[model samples]
Target: MVKTSKTVGRCEEFTANDVEVLGKAPLYQGFFSMVKYRFRHRLFAGGWSEPVDREMFERGHAAAMLPYDPVRDCVVMIEQFRVGAYAAGCAPWQLEIVAGIIEPEEVSEEVVRREAVEEAGLEVGELHKITRYLSSSGGCSETLDVFVGIADSRKADGIHGLPEEGEDIRVRGLSREQAYQWVESGKIENAASIIALQWLQLNYRKLQEAAQDLPLP
Candidate 1:
């Protein structure tokens, strides 16, 4: 076994300039694409490393929102069929937050609000940003922005989606505690859904305080 250093240096190489992109070749382009890249990066010890080649899946960025009504202490979640999960031999239908891809000219916040309406029939009010992260930097080039949006969760239960987009969604409302239990039970398996719900649990007191009055325009 190789023994590694127990201590590490400071993380100072924090920019694209640290790595050089030698070339990128498109492998496929459909709804999403695959690309091969050749590049090298600065070594932590000091010198630049050798060129390395890798392939990556490229689906554009997306925004996801968990609808919450602090006044009612409830949350909205959705269920939809995920082909990727089906292909992987997992359950084809997944429980997830309302989410949509960010179009080339659209912002994450706009996408989140639009998805809230299209997927759950909720008018997203004040959005509290939870986090932004790469879905899987090792293989996929998709960053996701997560938010908890203020909404009337009691009214958010129904089947809502755009048929033109081939979307069939079912919406459900659960008490905040029940939502978290679903997470712990592994029933809520989507990453964005899990993160958003966990964030709501952590910040619930603040959400209640904010909900005491209507958010301004």
Candidate 2:
């Protein structure tokens, strides 16, 4: 008998056409909707899989931004109470990058810019895209478009949020090193914050040089 190992590669052999969505039905509809999908996909070595039923939470999409003041070597972060964290048995108050849901037909950059002001009381300068990622691909239909926006950290303090929306956000400025340290120490738990800070760590020098070319505001 001989044992063989499968080769793992960067790209997969399967595409959407390989899967069939038999039917979809709404399970719950509220602030965020839930739906049940019946689908089947191609198997790794051969034929199709058995019909599968999965429930997916549909929260739409969102945009998140980490406000970096390259001139001051600081990053602005927001702290707020999140019900999701509380429900998950973690600390309710989370330190996170500014974020907001993207409404229909709204540009990602515009959504981040608006969220920056509403959540952190800071007006971002130039926008540098970081990445777009799914929040939870397994069970949620929420993709987040993340960015590192040039901002003035000096103006990032104070509590700011829309009262009508029940948001009470506290803004703080942290040195870039301290922010990254939080990521390393698990003090920053959200994916968006972690991704943004890690990216800034990798691209700090280039971002600083780019900031030098902008006119003083």
Candidate 3:
């Protein structure tokens, strides 16, 4: 077993720089093609290195919002079908937080708010930045910016989605207790939703107290 160390010095002679792909091996062919690519890279730490030609898949950033209504003590989530899961021989449909890819000209918060409206048909107010991290760092370059959004989650009417985009999202509202139960019951399966809900559970009291101190809108 490799022992973990926090204070390990950087290796000068043996350095691993960013890996780059030169070509790809075809994996799947559908609406979107999935491929594994060949790569060439360079390593530089104490000294400079030459550029190595490589190939990689084009990827985008995504955003997810955990809609929470402080007054109502409820949360809103969306359900959708994930193609990647189906390809991996798992459940294709998944319950997830409101999320979308970040457009080239759009900001992260804007992406989250737009996704909330598109996926759930809800207008969000102030947004609390939760965390930003890579979703699957192994093969994908997609990163996720997650936020806890303030909204009237209790007022969610029903499922809402954009037909033009082939989206058939189902919007659902759940009380804090219900959300927690779903997490425990294995109903909430998506990573972002699970992480956001768990974070909310841990910080619920502090957030509630903070919300109480805010002025009425």
Candidate 4:
């Protein structure tokens, strides 16, 4: 067994240069790719550790947004099928925020806005970034940028998403309180959805205040 020291501070002095990559190669390529990396890093206790091999899933980074209608105090959410959940022996369909991969040359905000339209049939305006996080740093290289966008929830009832992409999304509007309730009840299970909703819960009053002068849609 290995013992480690506990630290009180959040800041670490390690840099990317502290890790040395001896080799790397593609393990598989499909809708997503996997790569194997052999590397060693400087240890917190002392010297460099033994070279290690790890496989990384490379699905690319993504952007997700929760559309909030301040006038109605509602939020737009989407339900869609996710293979990962099915494989994990959980429910196949997931309640989630609008999200999409950030394709090459595209920005995170652009992806969020486009996904809102594609997944929910709703147009979003004035995105406020919530936070950015890694999906799973241990095995996946994907990161997600989360945001809250201004929208008119009355327009968000439909079945949308591109047929060619095998996407079938159901869009619905829920009161902000109701949505946060889902988060508390385990109904909203996905990370992006949970994070976005919690952020909304904490910052919604400020958002409502900021939108007060604007005319209701």
Off by over 4 Å in 2: 1-12
TM-score of 1: 0.90
For all predicted structures, in order, the TM-scores are: 0.90, 0.93, 0.76, 0.93
lDDT of 4 by residue, 1-217 (tens): 2223343235556666678888999999999999999988867766789999999999999999999998788999999899989998767999999999999999999998899889998878778998899999999989999999999999999899999999999998999999999999998889999999999999999889888876544
Best first by lDDT, ranked: 2, 4, 1, 3
Write one digit per residue (lDDT tens) for candidate 1, span 88-197.
77779998899999998999999999988889988888999999999999989899999998998767777889999899999989899999998899888789989999
CA lDDT, every prediction? 0.87, 0.90, 0.76, 0.90
Residue ranges of candidate 1 with Cα displaced over 4 Å:
1-11, 215-217
C-alpha lDDT of candidate 4 relative to the true structure:
0.90
**What is candidate 1's local distance difference test score?**
0.87
Q: Root-mean-square deviation of each candidate, in angstroms?
A: 5.1, 5.3, 6.3, 4.4
